[model samples]
Target chain A: MEINGVTIEDTFAEAFKMWGSRLIITAATEQWAMTTAQAATGFGTSIIGCGCEAGIGRVLGVDQTPDGRPGVEVLFFTTSKKSIAPVLLVRVGQCIMTAPTSACFNGLAAEKTVAVGGKLRYFGDGFQSSKLIDGRRFWRVPVMDGEFVIEEEFGMQKSVGGGNFLILAESQTAALEASEQAVAAMRQVPDIIMPFPGGIVRSGSKTSSIYKGMTASTNTAYCPTIRQQVESVLPEGVNSVMEIVIDGLTEGAIAEAMRYGIAAACQPGVVRISAGNYGGTLGQFQFHLKQIMA
Target chain B: MGSQLNSEKTTAVSINDDGVTLRLKAPITLPVEAESICPDCFVGCQQSEILALPVFCGRRRKMLGDIFSVSGEASDRITVEGDLTHFKRIGQGMSRGRLTLRGDGGMHIGAYMKGGEICVEGNTRDWTGAHMTGGMIRIRGNAGHFTGAAYPGEIRGVNRGTIIVHGDVGNETGARMRRGLIVVEGHTGECTGAGMIAGSVFVFGKLGARAGAGNKRGSIVALGETAPMLPTYQYQCRAQFGFLGVYLRQIRKWGIAVSDDLLKGSFRRFSGDVTALNKGEILIHD
Candidate 1:
């Protein structure tokens, strides 16, 4: 199947189960809130090296927040539930708490929760206090500017990670432009985040590498410069490729993002749309490219 | 003060209903014990049975039917109408359901309440929501002293729940409260939050004299005029607190008017009641 003269690969994208949590970071202003959110979710591109995959989900209005402040929603995904607590503790305590006039709140409502603020309350140094509003507990830790208010616990749930689509284009500019357009469209969907820089990954990796101790290596087959040195998967005219990876609270959300992203990427000079997988041997979920578009 | 009802009747009244209503038959001059008027008591009984429930009027034992006209089937929601200034214990120990008082309530209206919601359309006397553990109590008018407070000799009061008073309250509101939130939109009598163990009392109007006296780790926030602090309390600092905005915004959601200035304003913090834990704070809006 194809659209806009771009071939839609019959292959599916393999995704694994992950544990995810969402945080609502708010500050004195929208710019500050976005700044804090960016700082908190920064350096989180892939769980393999960064310990988690995180990105800003959306910007929020005052009416949409718990404290009636301009805010941003950020999502974090870890490979295991047990690791989510430590990852959040470091990110929220080091990143969010250090930001000016910022407060972090749990954005998800799940039965399973991890204590983030409860542990951070120690920063108050015997002056910490708590308030229980509508059965939800929030901690107030005194800070130099004022106080950092955060919910006592953050909810976590099983999620989906590594839902991606590849943009194969005839030129480097074409691939980059199509990838940017796809990322912009996919970002509009809720409960999902494209974890790579600018929501596009230029270095798409394979499951293994020739170098020792390397869990992942470059996808040589799709690399334009190394096409002659490797078994190239690109068609005759294809010269550049970029991938957009998605992580979301649910499988359906990932699929929805991928559908919008693929359609947006299939533009001028794009040769084909494909997905990377381990031949369907790994990952609990598989998103068939043609089936998703259908 | 939480009371358990007959198991069989508890099951009977658990069914959903349109709402049971009780109307006073005539004006009374003496205080009446109407604890049986609670939704838990009327849940399983028919209108006739509800009227047959016993009540103590002054020194006389009387049937509820003799004092008021009860209508509707057993249900979780109850409506009481009349001048209930003499009626006491109207919603004592109730664990569930909605109870609305169209008229003024006497003492102990929602003492020991565990769940559900109680909306008092008129004023209420002292001991409103005393010892309540859960649920919400909204008084649209002024409330007498000891609102959300512990009964004398009780160790804790209103451990969990919320009490919102739209008008001025008598002295010692939220006294000895262990936990929960109490918001008074108008001026308060003297000694508000006195002997508070742990809780929060927000007075939007003038705070009474000697507020937060003997407080043991609690917060008394005065958003309007504040009286002079006692010698036991010491000056802390003047700054903005993030938690206050959260609480104020939540109060606004409950239909209470909250100004933008108050929502974004800073407060002068005074850590006091040094005579006790010395950890309690009185925040005067700056």
Candidate 2:
């Protein structure tokens, strides 16, 4: 399949089940809310090194927030349910709690809960108090800037991670521009996060590494420099490839994200669009490139 | 507010006002516990069966049918019309359904109630909503002492739920309350929120002397005039609270009147009851 002269590969993108939580962070102003949200989601590109994959989901209006302040919603995903709380505690404590005039609330209403402010309340040194408002519990920890209010618990749900597609172009600038356009378009889709820096990963990896101790290594088949040395998958004239990795709350969300991303990446100078998968050896969710593009 | 009740799904029980004033001719005493008259518990009971339910009236055991004329089909919505100033424990411990009272209610109204709603069109005596765990109690007239407060020997009061009073309340309102919200649109007597453990007390009218005395950890928002606080309270800076908007919007849904200025204004924060937990705060609008 092809669109706008960009070839759509027949392969599929593999994704695994992950535990996820949505957080609504509100502040006295939009800048502060975005500041805290961006910092909280930083250094969280992939579970391979960051222990989580997170990104800013969207900017929320004042009427949409619980506190009636300008806010930002973020999506954080981890490999298991047990890891979600610790990651959230660390991120919120260091990023949001330290921010000025900020409050954190649970964005999701799942049955399964993880302690977010329940454990962070200890920072108050026995002075922390709680308030139950409209059936939701909020912890008020006395801070230097008045108080830091956070929900007692956050809901966790099963999510899909690692939904991705590769953008191959004739030059490095072409690949970068196409990937930027794809990220911009994918950002419009909700409940999904492109965790990579600039929403593009230059060093896409295979299932495992050639070394004994390594779990994953770079994808040699799509390497422009090693095209003559390996069994390259790139079509002729394709000199650069960049992948857009997506992690979302559901399979439908990921598919929607890929649809927007792949369509936007099929711009000028883009040669082909392909997906990475383990040939059904790993992960549970599979997004076929043709089906998603179609 | 009584008009909100759907008469089609309600069982109307009218009090028989005889010339001799037929009070509960009871074999048991101490203001009868009429908790079983709720729609949730009286699901399949006929009007005759409901009137047969035992109740105590001034040291006497009597049938509800002996005092009131019970009519209408059985349902979760019930309307009681009468001058029930002598009746106690109306809608007590009811976990689900809706109860509406047309006239004055006696003491212990909605005590220990876990869920559902109770709308009183008239006044209520002391101990209203005591030890209530959930649901809402809305009184359109004056309420006696200890509204949303703990019982004499109990440690907590109105653990969960909301109590909205459209008129004045007696002393010690919301005393020892552990959770939930109590909004008084009229004046309140002395020591409002005294010894409050946790929860919120929002008074839209004047507050009597020594408000928030010995409060441990809670919010006492005085939109109207309030008496001087105890010296134990330390003054904090003034600032606008963001959570009040959410709280006001929620209560406004129940038809409570809230001013736009109070919703957008700043408050002078006073952390008080240093003799107790010292974490409670009084936010008086500036």
Which candidate gets the maximum TM-score versus the true structure?
1
**A1-294 in candidate 2: lDDT tens per residue?**
999989999999989999999999999899999999999999999999999999998899977888778899999999999999889999999999999999999999999999889999999999888878779888888888777889999998999999999999999999999999999999999999999898899999876777999988989999999999999998999999999999999999999999999999999999999998888788999999999887
- lDDT by residue (B236-264, candidate 2, tens digit) is 89887756766876777779887777767
Query: What lDDT tens digits, residue by residue, belong to model 1 across residues B182-261?
Result: 99999999899989998899999899999999998899999989887888899888888888878899999999889989
Model 1 spans with C-alpha error above 4 angstroms: B1-3
Clash pairs detected, candidate 2: B26-B60, B26-B61, B27-B60, B27-B61, B28-B59, B28-B60, B28-B61, B29-B59, B29-B60
Candidate 1 interface RMSD to the true structure: 1.0
C-alpha RMSD of candidate 2: 5.6
* TM-scores of the models, in the order given: 0.97, 0.90
lDDT of 1 by residue, A1-294 (tens): 989989999999999999999999999999999999999999999998999999999899988888888999999999999999999999999999999999999999999999999999999999888888888899988888888999999999999999999999999999999999999999889999999999999999988898999989999999989788899998889989999999999999999999999999989999999998998889999999998999
Candidate 2's displacement at residue A266, Å, is 2.6
Q: How accurate locally is residue A11 in candidate 2, as Cα lDDT from 0 to 100? A: 93
The residue-level lDDT of candidate 2 at A244 comes to 95
lDDT for A88 (candidate 2): 98
